[model samples]
Target: MTTDTDTALEVTPDAAAAEFDRQVRTLLALGYPALSGRSPEQFAALVAPLRAEAVARAGSAAYPAGPAGPETAPAVTGRVPFVLVVGRALAPVERTMPLTTLHGGRLPGFVDRSFEPGSLERFLATEEARPPGRDGVHLLCEVERGEEFCGVVPGDAMATVAERGRTPLTLEEGIALLTLFPEILVKNKCFSLGGSRCGDRRVPALWISKRAPKLGWCWEGNPHTWLGMASAGARHA
Candidate 1:
């Protein structure tokens, strides 16, 4: 879903770096400190590892598929469900999904594109009804590769390459790093909707996060791509 427009900023960095090196260097440049309100040195130290991790993973992880599709799990009833929408047909793939986030925002990498328009309205309406803090949000997700990313900035252990004099990364340090880079995520996977669309059609997973969606930021399907969604997940009433 889109960030609350008022919440959306003109200067907010790209959700993820499109061109990693240029983005990193621009943020690290001396004049760039104002972007994060941090000194250049401080900003550079925080984001370098994150850029490396994302780049490395994007380059290295391309394994052959073992299973033809995601396991056929069942829908969970009673507990809040994360509806895994894949095709134009709105159906549940799995339920009782467990997802976490750092900001009020959904962990990005769900998919780069936005969700359907009504998502935020539903989220706000649900939040207005809630006591406060817990999100019973509906999301129209255009999911991404789940095995690749996480919502939280990864721990210091992820800092593989380091400056000679600086201490290596740590958990506490990683958490603190968010003040500078809210987008950095721990290397982990979330539920993925990738390969759900086998044919040229594009479908979305309207998962209920904290609870799921029909976010307005959904990706428009390409006419050239055929849609093929797997029939996975259990159906419950």
Candidate 2:
């Protein structure tokens, strides 16, 4: 039988770096939310640090530092596979465009529900399915595309609910959280679960936002964003 090792081949550092840059550019062309507001130079700068960190973690053989300098390197650790969860908010009409444009004229009906107590478990049972990845640092992304700005929590991170007061999450906080953990954040507005499946697992769940768009946000034509959740078994591969 063909194993992962049989298919696995070595990649040079330069080739890997070039491929990474290419992927980033491709994502930008696809209207990634993180790269939307920033200029090309600014976007490059933002991703530079991340690229350095990834290289350092992967080691010199897989991703050498090159002429960039040692400061760019991130601490080395074990590697794993990961999936990014992209979410976005859309109006009844706005949502139709992506559905028609991206999914061949059919509308996808993803339900909206709060992440209350037992919500994760229920979602896992009903909505989520296993995703493809390595054994360590597995990632599962759940996006909430909606009209309003809601909050998101990392799958690995925990949240607490208060009885007398409101939840401990805000829209900005949620986006920031995803930004901080870009490995699991797809940073896109449109996604199709049925078509975008990894391995045998469909996905954990997607949280479609129901809030209104925030003012001063750069992306046009769409007023929503996505938040993805991931597991420890998932990582960026």
Candidate 3:
């Protein structure tokens, strides 16, 4: 007596793996869409006609940044585990490796549907509020081969985002938002969250991006951040 609903909900290892891969690709694509996260075939699809053009440019690359400033200390590049609460969904973006995400769509080969409009700005605003004190965010980055290290997020790095036109989130506005009540920003994700038992704690695994490469936020490298998000719901005032 097999029902269609049971067949649809059956836990298939392959399907779960695919879901995880999608999320990982989304994270990496959002973080460093310029490079990384692709197979040779996928890369070919993205560049096909322009592949050689890009290679010609890469081979002629120069040490343009010259030298690092006190600002760019800790040198390597990295990004924090981000949580983007969009409309009725949560888009988690991270600067890390994409596990099993396979090809197609712009550069870095992410599932394009993963992103939502204007979410990047909101994410940037959050990061600017409590930046990684000179030491850098919790990201374990590997920018220079054999010279891997955690990268610094300059106090004014948010300004760089604006200069590059990555996001419209102005550094000025981010600083201002920090002092206000957290509820104003709106955590619809949490409000919409439901939970299940994973032992003692009720894990809000659903909070992870729909594109995530794994089942839970603990896989995000910053599980503790969820605590802050949860507690913020009830203001001490």
Candidate 4:
């Protein structure tokens, strides 16, 4: 009886924004160019529109109620499946940093605070949730990230957003989520970086990327990292 619907959560535009901001800041601090600019305010202004677009896309999707029936849909049993959709306008430049290179040799507390609680940690806990073989699709919304700019997920994929508490996302929270889940670090890929705004209103070009696997790092093969991001998103859901 388990279904995607049972695992899916409704998210709002505001909540998406908050998670995006949190993720972006985390990447910047971790030596990732997820967010490169002057001032927190400027960065916030740059990413807002992308977040809004993501929220809209998530809202419009017809996500599964839980695990689909054997004949009705693919069985997404075992660990709950979810997706983390990111939207940016620029691609990340090639760069590798030792653990010591991280600001203070570790992920800052602020970055931790931004994580969607148990999203990443929990998602990586199970083999079924790991990328490349996982059943779900993680979408990315990049303006110029790579060959798959704009939409990262296929048309047949099921999609939904993870909500925090009862409110939608704010810019800060969204960025924090990205920081906790840097798996979006695909090579030759970048997210949107610039946009227009009027007065206090800002327009972010929006970059998008999905959480996938690479061939490096201490925990590169483990699922812990992916689970961490998923767990965080679930908490918000």
Candidate 2, 216: how far from true, in Å? 29
TM-score between candidate 3 and the true structure: 0.19
TM-score of each: 0.21, 0.31, 0.19, 0.30
Cα lDDT of model 4 by residue, 42-81, tens digit: 5445444455455665443222233442122212222211
Tens digits of per-residue lDDT, candidate 2, 1-237, equal: 112332322344554455445545544554453323556565555445445433433332322223323232211111121112222221121231122111121233223333233332222111122323332111232122221122333211212112212122222222322222222222243222221122332233333232212111111122223522222221232
Give the C-alpha miss distance for residue 65 in model 1, angstroms. 22
Q: Candidate 2: minimum summed lDDT over ten consecutive residues — where?
A: 74-83
User: Residue 120, candidate 4: how far off, in angstroms?
Assistant: 27
Tens-digit per-residue lDDT, 1-237, candidate 1: 121221211211221233334444533542334434457676555445444333333322111212211111111111111121111111111111112233345542121135343332222111111211222111111111222212312221112111212121111111112212222222221121221222222323222233122111223232111211111111111
Candidate 1 regions off by >4 Å? 1-19, 28-32, 61-237
Best by TM-score: 2
Query: How far in Å is the alpha carbon of 232 misplaced in model 3?
Result: 33
lDDT of 3 by residue, 1-237 (tens): 111221112223333233223323443444322333445345324323322222222222111121331111111111111111111112123222122221111122122333345433343323222222231111111111100111212212223333433321222221111111121122222110111112222222222234332222222123332221211110000
Q: Candidate 2 versus the native: TM-score?
A: 0.31
